[model samples]
Target: MAQNKQKRGPMQFLQFGVIGFANAAIDIGTLNLLLLLFHTDAKGLLLLYNTIAYTLAVANSYYWNVIITFKRSAEGSNRQRILFIVQGLVSLGVNNLIFLGVNELLQLIGINNWLQYNVAKGMAMFLSFLASFFMVKYVVFRDYGKRYIDEKN
Candidate 1:
């Protein structure tokens, strides 16, 4: 069992990476689509669009990470679901802060365009991705005694 866990560690990370890529695509794609459709580059709208995009990606992440990456049995208990949501919201806050910060810095430097927005988004996605992976693995889906949650002895 220990040997299996040792081997599965790296494999699980790889699977998580694959899922992360898909999540990134969904996130960035949705944000860009919103930008294009609305034809507005307003800062406030960017936040709104980013939130929508991130939320969609997070939903996808929860689905795939449970089934393929973390390999949890099913949808899991209410506590697990609540933890996921809390983690996701924290990650989203991290993502948005980085995104807005980077974009603002770029604008201050006179670099304003799609490239700037994407650059900020990319940085946000990467940092939040790392945070999300750790939280999901160690906190959300971690095994506890006979189940994913601890029971009273």
Candidate 2:
């Protein structure tokens, strides 16, 4: 006898990708807008802008990923929410560090600030997506000990 396996379909991946794009847009758009409004050279201001934008994007991604992207695979209770939030914060820190580092490197290389900002944001988005996806798959929406028992029974 063959056992049943849950396979993720193309549509599922598409939906997740769409949600990821939306979250990335929100994050980058807000950061760019803030940069435009604030012409100050203060490092704190940049960090503040990134924090605000990242928080909003993370919240949006969490809800959408839970309700849409990984809905079929998600088996955890609200207990996973804390872990999700912690993982998000950690990802945010990593992303912000990379973004700032890239932006500074571009500036040092004489690239225009506007173009540098966009490039940095794009790079950060790609890196953060990889980090977040693995965290969500393994920690947030992991199987709740049911699969092994079911397989044996």
Candidate 3:
């Protein structure tokens, strides 16, 4: 008989990647649509546009990760959702920092202006994805030996 085993380590990362691919598509699609609509360069308003796109994709990622990646949910789904959103906001900050850093590096080399926002965003998302996976695993969805830990006596 074969025992049922759950994903761990690299497998976890792989699962995250699958969901991340979907998220990336949503993010890039929204970004490009916004750019086409407003004609804004992916420069000064890049972070703003990217954050908007990321926010939408994040909702998709949260549910998928909970159902597929983590294979668990918090006692109260609402609490879990709020926590997930908090984690996402933090990851967004990390992503923006990385994206800006990558952009600066490309700038130092010149011709970076020719590069699209997706270039730096791709790298940033990878880093943020790693961070997010860990955050969701160890923090957001940890089984703390309680269903709903009551805060009031």
Candidate 4:
């Protein structure tokens, strides 16, 4: 990873925030649908459900961040796309860390597992969203080439 961050305006941050909110909704919606379809909340099932929902949310994030938030032209290359995935992976790690940690802590304190898991998820999502905005805005989506990319200056 390259770390050449370009200066961005407040409006761009707002656009990114809007997209994040949409994706967060998608994530929660997917999780709920999965739970309904399976009619169970086993540990393995919860993990699988969350994984699927997170992936969909990540895909949605990529699309909207590139199309609406970043507003890049058709200059994105394979290299940049790979970096985008890398950034997402890092974000996922950050999210999972907070989620598992919080959940475990709640369990230790005798919190109801169901409520504990949800609260953990919400907290993790908040922290990961913050991390992802910085990574996408400064690293993954930053212009890295010249004639190959007419990046927003």
Candidate 5:
């Protein structure tokens, strides 16, 4: 079982990466579209667009991750769903905060707005990917019984 679990971990990670890439593309693409459509130079509007896009991406991620990446770990319990949502919200907050901070810093350093936005989004996505993997693996979908039991006990 331990070996099987170990094998599954890498497969899960790959699936998670694929799903995350799709979701992040959706989010960044939506934000860019909104920016292009608005023709506005307001930071607040960008933030607002990001918030909306992130929410949509989170929802998409939850479904895909549950069905694809963590299918074996998924429980058909309301508690599991709630836990997943909480984990996602935490990731969302971390990603958004990092994005805003990095973007602002780049702006202050006189980086071009286009490059700043792309770089900030890329960094935030990478960080959030790491954060979400750990949270989902150790918190939301943890196998408590397996962890507490020992082979020689």
Candidate 6:
């Protein structure tokens, strides 16, 4: 798959990072909204809220990453979509694990609060952002020649 990484410029990575900031806002905002509304720090509830927020941000990520970041001309074939979703699930796993793990550590350190929660969430987002970028670039939007269903076709 390394060969599929064409001579793309670092500018694309910068774009991905910019888009990632938007995604992070969506993710953190949604999670905070849920936490504020529910007023609970329970483990299961936090996981559920985090999942909802992460999923929403991922949907936005898929759209912008395809149209702007990668700048693909494909008509978004089912295969490509499936690949994107698969990578998303994997990234979600990465995110959730980091979140829960960090949250647990903060709890052990007796620092449970809004700031602590966000500290965990931020770490999760940053790591998973890197994972998602590479997966989308090398796997989902890799050069597949005529396999892509171009709109002009």
Best by lDDT: 1
For 82-136, candidate 4 gives per-residue lDDT tens digits of 8788988888888777877887788889987567877877887888898988888
Clashes of each: 0, 0, 0, 0, 0, 0
Q: What is the C-alpha RMSD of each candidate to the true structure, in Å?
A: 3.3, 2.7, 5.3, 4.7, 2.5, 4.4
Q: What is the C-alpha lDDT of each candidate?
A: 0.88, 0.79, 0.76, 0.75, 0.82, 0.86
Ranking of all predicted structures according to lDDT, beginning with the best and ending with the worst: 1, 6, 5, 2, 3, 4
True-vs-predicted CA distance for residue 98, candidate 3, Å: 1.5
For residues 79-147, what per-residue lDDT tens digits would candidate 5 score against the true structure? 778888898888888888888999989989999877888788888878988998989988888766645
Q: Please report how far candidate 2 places residue 47 from its true position, in Å.
A: 1.6
lDDT per residue for candidate 3 within 16-91, as digits (tens), equals 8999999989887887788677766456687787788888888889868777877743454777778888999999
List runs of model 2 lying over 4 Å from the truth. 1-6, 9-13, 73-76, 149-153
Model 6 earns a TM-score of: 0.87
Give the Å shift of residue 145 in candidate 1. 2.4
- TM-score of candidate 5 to 2 decimals: 0.88
Error of 4 at 20 (Å): 0.7
Poorly placed runs, candidate 6 (over 4 Å): 1-7, 146-153
- Each candidate structure's TM-score, on Cα atoms with residue i matched to residue i, is 0.90, 0.85, 0.79, 0.79, 0.88, 0.87
Query: How many backbone clashes are present in model 2?
Result: 0
C-alpha positional error of residue 56 in candidate 3 after TM-score superposition, expressed in Å: 1.3
Displacement of the residue 143 alpha carbon in candidate 5, Å: 2.8
Q: After superposition, how far is residue 133 of candidate 4 from its true place, in Å?
A: 1.0
Clashing pairs in 4: none
77-102 per-residue lDDT for model 6 (tens digits): 89989999999999999999999999
Candidate of highest TM-score: 1
